[model samples]
Target: MWFRLDLRTLDNPALWEASQNGPVIPIFIWSPNEEDIMPGAASRWWLHHSLEKLGAKLRELGGKLILRSGKSLQNLKSLAKNTGARAVYWNRRYEPLIQKRDDKIEDELKKIGLEVKVFKANLLAEPSEVENKSGLPFKVFTPFWKQCLKQLNTEKPLQPPINFEKRELEPESCNLSELNLKPNHNWAQGLEQEWNPGESNAHLNLKLFINEALKKYTEARNFPDCLGTSRLSPYLRFGEISPKQIWHAIEESGEENWKESQYLTEIGWREFGYHLLYHFPHTISEPLRPAFNRFEWTDNSDHLRAWQQGQTGYPLVDAGMRELWATGWMHNRVRMVVASFLVKHLLIDWRHGAEWFWDTLVDADLASNTQGWQWTAGCGADAAPYFRIFNPVTQSKKFDPAGSYIHRWVPELRGLKPPYLFEPWNAIDIELSAAGIRLGQNYPYPIVDHSKARIRALKAYEKIKK
Candidate 1:
């Protein structure tokens, strides 16, 4: 069975069922140039480690993980031919490019007389199955989520396949070093400190989050400084964890707090995103809301560079962007604020931000990331209203009231009073100097005035309103 991104076996419907058919030869393919398709350097690093762990786990179970590279179809065909394998199996992936690739592979393999099977294992339900009463995909979230709840008759998660007999298949695998992915900065040090790769780590993290953090997640998730979230996004994106395991665990935890509702809703948001991707494949590169195509974005390379490097003179936005650059991850709330700052405040195109996130976020799933950027930019189904631009200073005070998160990521401002840290430009010289704040040195001045930018954004959006 070929595993693309789904690395873990626990609750993996495809992997578990494949073992039932016969002796299973688990496999992973590495494309040297495919790292470009990955979310970012940190994601590639995580993939390398996850693949290593997968190999070890399979070996322990007396099965071997075959590693191959090059064109996925060409590589798989060669492996099948060499082993005289009759069938290939995998969980289905929903991205347009992936769907195209899989279709071609299925046809090629069937013509060669090999049984090809694909299973739905990633999402809670097939995206196409949860349409509205009219059999049309819902563009908005609330109704879609409500429909999803009605359709779910979830089963308990499956245990890891423990009884697999040995199978021998060893083809050349890519040397991890050849992937050419490494952080250009020191940001990923914390990522290494925080995350452990593979299925076992995914389970350990999930259990830990459920046991200690789940109840408080609704409150704590907004603060970047807190351990209020499952931190399972990367694990999920890499397929080191399955959604079914997460679903059942949440169901069993039975927490009756607002946090439970909040976290589950967040998961629902992910489902909503996948649904959009499955139904509207072109939405990846095109705006889901056609009117958004008319919005005029600025061609300000200077502003774009500042935003990318997390130096936009807005502390909260800068901190969030820097955090993403350094660690390849950003808090959910911060994701919204920073995305707003980019598309609304800076007037940059949403695609530019999406591309950067694709290359930087460890948890970058094409469906989720594209949808998220579009949602923030008011170009997606049920997107945040375009004129509802986030004020970074206000967001900072509201979410990180104490400036603890700001101090952590924006350490140069560590000396500032909590009140002024969010907007040091307004501070008296004495206060600024005491806080080690310099107009362009200790902390940057606000790049663009919030009120002015908001007006500009509204005017640009006005063109599309009709």
Candidate 2:
């Protein structure tokens, strides 16, 4: 069995059910080209550690996660030939490029007289299964989520199977360093400290969240400074945690409180993203709303660099970006604001920001990144209206509130007052000097004027309306 995102054995439908039929052969392909699609260096480092943990877990179960390099199809064919394996099984992938590649491989494997099976392991509901009354895929999230909830009432999550027949194979596994990713890069120290990526850690985190944090998730999720939201996105993205297990865990909690409802809504949002991905394949590259494609985007590399480095001079936006760069994760609220600044304030292409997130975020999944960036750019289904631009200063004051998150990521501003935390440029000479802050030296001036950029973006978008 070949594993893509479905990394864990527990609650993994494809792995569990496949093991029941015959001896299971787990495989993971480490392809450099594919890795380049997203998560350039930092993500690769995380993958290296994740695969290590998964391999260790599989070994304990009398199996091994076979690591290989090169094109997935070529590698699978070679493995099948060496071991005389009869079947190739894997979870499905929905991105534009991956879907095409998988389809080609499926055809080639079938032609070579091997049975190939694809399982729905990534999402809660198969994207194709949820459709509107008219038999068309939904572009809006509300209707899509409602349909997902309806389907969940019909079918629930599957547990990990413990009864797979152990298969023995001496297939060659590649060493981690053979993948030739940029070595000597240790920029992800904070990410390593913040996240433990593997099946055991994922499962433990889920149990803890269900037991403790979930109840307060409803209120805490909105506040960036609070640890209210389930920090399970990276695990979910990597398939270390299954959505079915999460679904069942929440149900088993049995409190049925409003917080549970809110938490489930977030899961629904995850489904909504996959549903959009399935329906609109082109959304991976193209805009969901075609008119937005005509909007003029400034090719301001300096501003983009500032945003990426978290030096945008807007505390909230800078903090979020810095957090992502440092820890490969950021709060959901700040994600929205920083994304808004890129697309609406800087007037850069949303794809640019999305690509950066793809490279940096541990939680970066194709569907979520696509949905989020498109939503911010007003180019996605159920996106905010094109006119709504987030004011970064106000957003910082609202979400961070006490400047705790800002100070944590932006230590240079630790001693600044709460009022000026959002806008240090407003500090007078004495106050600025007292705080040891200099506008352009200690911290950046706001790269783009929010009010001015808002009007420019609106005008630029207006040109596309006609």
Candidate 3:
């Protein structure tokens, strides 16, 4: 079994099929060259631990996972030659470059008379399976998801294989440490504290979300202070759990109208992101809407730096950036606020924000990352309108009324009260002194005035509109 993103044992169609054929030689080839964009630091950290967990699980089933690096084709050929393995089976990945590479590999393997099979394991529905009334890929989410809801696979996920017929010849394998997936510095300490990356933990988190947070998800999810959202993105990204498993788990939850639940809609959005990526691959770097190609964006390094370092002086934006830097994750609502601040308030390129998130987020996925940044920047399919610039202070007060979320990540502002907490510059000298704040000293003043920034962004939008 050639493992790429599908890292788990259960519901892994490729692994199950390979096991049924005969003795399984599960191999993971660490070929970064095959990836369109290399996995980021946080992603690599998660992968390192996840691989350890998967190796242990396979060992329990009386099998070993072979680890190899460099060209996938060369490694696979060498392994097949040594083990006398005649067939290759694996799950699929949907990234543009990875898909092309896999197709070429499959063709080459077939030429050598090796039987190759690929199965869909990660997404609930293949991108090719879903379409609009005209039979073209969807540009809008509602109709696309409505179509998907009709055809979504209701089958229960496959159970992990109980029996393992280990091959007698163990091909030479490299140790997991040799992959150097983990970072060299101590930056990953916060990530380790916040996450447990593995198949088992994925299920546990799903169960917790179902029992504790599912009902209140609609309202509570907006508040970053509450643990209202399911923290399962990284797990899904690495294929520790399949979307099919998540869908079935909710089905068995006995929630009334579970299919149309808000939580499921979020899952549908993930599917939608992949759908857009598969159909409109150029949108990975370019805007889906052609006019945005000529949209002028500012090149302010200082503003970009402030937004990245969480020194934007906008409480919510700063808090979210710091949270992402510290924990390798940020609340979804805050992500929009920060992303909008970058593209609209700062007028920096959306690609810059995308690239930064690609490096920082543990759950950073190409399709999702590209879709989200473009959406926030008002450039991709079904994107937020460019005229709708998010006011960071307004969003801060609305979602984080108590300021608890801001306090947690931006502790320097913890002393400020209601109005001033969200916007410290608004505080009177007495209030600022009472709250132990000194604007531009410890806490930063607003980097760009919301009223001014909004007007600037709108004027820029006018250029494209014309």
RMSD after CA superposition, every candidate? 2.1, 2.1, 0.9
Candidate 2, residue 347: how far the Cα is off, in Å: 0.9
Q: List candidate 2 stretches off by more than 4 Å.
A: 32-39, 153-169, 180-183, 257-260
lDDT of 3 by residue, 271-387 (tens): 999999898888888999999989999999999999999999999999999999999999999999999999999999999999999899999999899999999999998999999
lDDT of 2 by residue, 1-466 (tens): 8888888877676787678787777889976565326456666766777888888888878787789888888999999898878888888888767788888999999999999888887777888788899999988877888778778642466655544345454678877667654336678677778888898898789888878888787788988888787899988988888877777778788756532398878888888898888788788888999887777889999999999999889988888998888788989999999999999998899999988988888887878999999998889989988799988888878877898989988989988978888888887788888888888997988988877898898899889988
lDDT of each: 0.83, 0.83, 0.92
> Where in model 3 is the C-alpha error above 4 Å?
163-165
Candidate with best lDDT: 3
Q: Choose the strongest candidate by TM-score.
A: 3
**Between candidates 2 and 3, which one is better according to lDDT?**
3
Give TM-scores for every candidate, taking all chains together and pairing residue i with residue i: 0.95, 0.95, 0.99
Instruction: Write the candidate numbers in order of decreasing TM-score.
Output: 3, 1, 2
lDDT of 1 by residue, 216-239 (tens): 887888887788899899999988
TM-score of 1: 0.95
Backbone N/Cα/C clashes per model: 3, 3, 0
